[model samples]
Target chain A: DVKVTQSSRYLVKRTGEKVFLECVQDMDHENMFWYRQDPGLGLRLIYFSYDVKMKEKGDIPEGYSVSREKKERFSLILESASTNQTSMYLCASSPSDSSYEQYFGPGTRLTVT
Target chain B: AQSVTQLDSQVPVFEEAPVELRCNYSSSVSVYLFWYVQYPNQGLQLLLKYLSGSTLVKGINGFEAEFNKSQTSFHLRKPSVHISDTAEYFCAVTEGNSGYSTLTFGKGTMLLVSP
Candidate 1:
């Protein structure tokens, strides 16, 4: 069974604070993604990494950045947290050869106050 | 670019009743379709996926979906649902040729099963 683990299950940060959400996959998948899910807005992609040190912006990448220094770990960075950034963040990983299905980690619910 | 639309925002059903959640997608090239379930405060879990070969795909938890290319729809259905089946279901699509494999998800349909 594939296991994707997130660093934090829940987090609360003040406005203008820096936040980091980490994700690690034991499957050694080459593709990792970060998404923020909102009610009625759906799961919008924030950023994705295809390989180490390679990143691409998704539909909504503003105020967010990602790091993939290693194949097993992917991190999501909030430049400066705001109230609007408060939401559930999900991390997913898929194999490079077969990207059809992705395994997701338990999400992190971030609250910015 | 690929996009997915889940027409129904909410579907309420009784225990042991049948239920259907509609999903439509738009993409010029070949696409892969998937349905995911998210419990309260949990991450999304892959329910089913339609890659190739078969149009009717069955997934875990007795959930199934039919891929209709002509209609551009992949609707999920279950014959008998349980109270534990209550969750948010999302439909997603990815372009076959894009190589990125990033998914575009629908707004999601909330399934409320009551006794």
Candidate 2:
């Protein structure tokens, strides 16, 4: 079974604080993605990495960046946390050559104050 | 650009009752359709996908969806739903024949199953 794990299930941060959200997938998938889920907005992609050290911006990449130093680990960094950025963050991984099915992490609910 | 629309924002149904969630897509090119389910406080899970071949595709948890090219719709259906089936369902679409899968999702439909 494919297992995706996140660093935190819930997080609280003050405005202007820097924040890091970590995600790791046990499966050696090449494609990794970061998405933010909001009420009535559904899931919107923030960033994705096709390989280590290779990243691409998604639809909503503003106020956020991603790092994939190693294959299994992908991190989302908030340059400066803001109240409008509060939402549930999800990470997903999929095999680049084989299947397009994405396996997702439990999620990290971030609250900015 | 591809876009998806889920007609119902919320569907309330009794346990063991049949349910259907309507979805429509707008894209000039061909597209792949998908339905994802998210339980309360949980991440989204792939319920089913329609790439090609069959119009009626079956997925996990006894859920299925039909792809209609004429109407540009892909509606999800389940014969009998359980309380555990209550969750948020998202309809998504991606450009077909693409090297990468970048899905565009709809707002979502909240399925509330009552016992």
**What's the TM-score of each model vs. the native?**
0.98, 0.96
Query: Candidate 1 chain B: minimum summed lDDT over ten consecutive residues — where?
Result: B94-103
Candidate 2, residue A37: Cα displacement in angstroms equals: 0.6
Chain B TM (all candidates): 0.97, 0.97
Single out the weakest 10-residue window by summed lDDT for candidate 2 chain B. Answer: B94-103
- Top candidate when judged by DockQ against the true structure: 1
Candidate 2 segments exceeding 4 Å error: none
How well is each residue in B22-94 modelled by candidate 2, as lDDT tens digits? 9999999988899999999888899999988999999999999999999999999999999999999999998
A1-113: candidate 2 lDDT, tens digit per residue:
99999999999999999999999999988889999999999899999998999999999999999999999999999999999999999999988752467888999999999
Evaluate residue B115 in candidate 2 and report its C-alpha lDDT on the 0 to 100 scale. Answer: 94
lDDT of 1 by residue, B1-115 (tens): 6889999999999999999999999999989999999998788899999999899999999999999999999999999999999999999998866455788999999999999
DockQ of each candidate relative to the true complex: 0.69, 0.62
